[model samples]
Target: MLEPEHGLIRQVEHAHTKCWVCVLSCLLLASVYVGSLYVWRSSLPRDHPSVIKRRCASVLLVSALSPAAVKAWIHWADIRVDVSVWELMGVRLEGFVPALILPLLLTMVFYLGPLVHSAMDDPDGFTTELQSVLDVQSWRLCVRDVVWLRNQVVAPVTEELVFRGGMLPMLVPCAGPTAAIFVAPLFFGVAHLHHIIEQQRLQRDGMSVILLVAGMQFLYTTVFGAFTAFIFMRTGHIVGPVLCHSFCNSQGLPDIGFALQHRERTALLFSYLMGALLFLVLLFPLTDPFFYGAIPVCSLAPAPEPVC
Candidate 1:
């Protein structure tokens, strides 16, 4: 019944609003999610099939329990907004079509170089790749790959659900939409710090290098987390962020250096630059709530602001 607030106080109107409470809740949620992965003791490497599957189960359990944060908010915050926890987390059916397409398209725009390079580098050509994609058998192969499934499917769904979907609602109540977009992702980035332990255990690199790589990964995930959070708030739909997250996972990071050194460097560079430009230009318009329906995110905020 009691939601404690501690740490830096963030100003907000109303009899009581606790951004710090939401933040601490997020930290606890993220810690549990990350800590769950290590509960299954195994000498096997992180990538081992058994280890990966067990960790997957652990994370999923934590992810499933994450909605408790929202439930706690509903009870203690005495929230004024008219919204169900499901709608606040963007689980509703409305605006789904745009959610399913627009976010993914906008994300693809960010990786145009890699996409083109991947197609051109295909020895058998784009048609073969297209056919493979269309082939149900290839999909079966994909399903069989545990690591691929973890990355492209389970990770995206659970992560967006818990990190962006669950956390953002709590955050927006006190942080405001813009601040929520930036703040919620910090927990996401911190959750990834567990990777340092895995890499260090494997001794794949020196401690400094491992730390550096972990730092870079943290940066990447945090930035990507912010993007997903933005779209989630904008479209007021979790499906859009989930789709975008999965697509980004499949694409991985685009290698600007590789594009610069590619044999067809000119075209690749152009595509890369243009893709960045297009993504920036289309970011707001594509995610405009006008296309997605009413700003369901408003349901999460305590009071309507320009953000809603």
Candidate 2:
């Protein structure tokens, strides 16, 4: 029904709008990436008197800027920011528990399965190994550390706010869910690569070791970034990924393939492998829109009609 010139004009406007969204998203991501490095490099030790204030200020700045950026993009794109913080950021109590539990359970099954299998294989060594692992002093030290609290809590919340909450939704309109999921996480993974610089500063490791470590970290974080992005898209909330990120930080990566020698250990490994496989198999159905009432059918566009 539109005239040729009118259609052409519309197309041009759409193209320009898309370009603006992409450019703004990139700028926001770049600022967060650079800002994170500056914060890390300039931050004092946890034991220092001014550490809390400095770190708090840095986090506050990023947190403020993230939502502001999101607002700007949504406005520029002529979209509505209708989702709540829980919906937008995924912080709902309903989803958060499962999000945290599943990953932790899987990690535990993978890492502790081998050790448990080893323990079962030799009852004599079980007590010693258990005692070594259960050392109250070590547990106490970890619990008491302020740095651990910051890493587990503050970092997860803020990083998710920036990467998943701010950058991802804006990207969905332009890139769609599939591309946005992986694309936003690429920046998230790259942000952590700064750790290699920190590592280099503190340790006298050769370039090879540093590079290897950095590469591994980049790979895993990028993979995890995809996962968090998927979770964000599925739940339509930021909390899901935030809690998951914190849990992942606390648990670290599982060391697999070490208990292959003994038959019992191998069996345990197989069990865990199967469990992980099952989780992967069910992940989609479990996260499907029909399963959660809180997940609304909405699009990144400004349409009055919802897009499921």
Candidate 3:
């Protein structure tokens, strides 16, 4: 294959349109969703069950469903072909392995390791808090089913599209990779505060529990959010974050249940440290495109300068 004799930026300019749009959408949504979360926070009771349901629904609709629908529409209508003139062509990977896979792998290491440890520390305790408030109903099965479906399937699909697909691109131009990564997680944590508060409403002493439980949940989501953003940035694929998120969320639940059951101090500390580590890692410069790699080419590469 013929190769260009310019910086990496020159190469990316000629890449595919659909690919760029997908990446761009990820970045844009991440920022918008984060902004929306902040706006809605004060209006809702942090510990109300209805508030949690509403917040979850809002996020799901905006981040995943809407964007996916738009994508489908564009593809089906053949708008992609019409928009081809605006695309960056020739962005094929240089080798068998995607350059992004390594960075993504390392990021997973930091996110998953800590998340697992944290969940193990705070096991089934969250459940007791929920059960004590209600008459021990058979809804346990339903709750479990919903939680699994929500986290494993629904959440991953919706959240990945928003943070990684939509909002992330908006940040890349303004903040570059470093800020983009942190911003996504920060917003993710803020967004989940509603759910934590919802959990609190089920308890008698709602105010007292809200802070602790919300903080724990926030720590869990923020780390994963950052990691997912990293996946989007590196691989430029929406699926990366969804897979990582589902895997991470699935692994942590049982451990969290166990921690709640035993109420072990070691478990708590272990989980906390893991969150802290991830929090700290969020600040590090871990292979950002602008910082460490060759310049990227865009589809918008101007006509080649006439040879002087």
Give the CA lDDT, 0 to 100, for residue 198 in model 3.
Answer: 48
lDDT of 2 at 268: 73
**Worst lDDT 10-window in candidate 3:** 299-308
Model 1 residue runs over 4 Å out of place are: 1-17, 123-125, 302-307
Pairs in clash, predicted candidate 1 = none
On residues 89-113, what C-alpha lDDT tens digit does candidate 1 reach at each position?
8888888888899999999898887
Any runs in candidate 3 off by more than 4 Å, and if so which?
A: 1-60, 64-145, 204-206, 253-308
- Assess each prediction's global lDDT (C-alpha) against the native: 0.83, 0.66, 0.51
RMSD for each model, in Å, please?
A: 4.5, 5.1, 11.9
What is the number of residue pairs that collide in model 2? Answer: 7
C-alpha root-mean-square deviation, candidate 2: 5.1
TM-score of each: 0.91, 0.75, 0.47
lDDT of 1: 0.83
lDDT of 3 by residue, 178-245 (tens): 56678757767876776554455456466757787778888978877876766555444555467667
Of the two candidates 1 and 2, the one with more favorable lDDT, higher being better, is 1
Candidate 2 backbone collisions, by pair: 89-237, 89-238, 89-239, 90-237, 90-238, 90-239, 91-239
Candidate 2 lDDT for residue 93: 57
Q: Candidate 2 residues 1-308, lDDT tens each?
A: 66998999997899678767765776666577456545644434444536644665677677766666666666677765567533554545555555555544543443455445656668787776557567988667766666775677777888887778777776676666677788888887777777676667667588889999889988998988887777777766666677778867865675455556555666777766775776677666656655444553145523332222
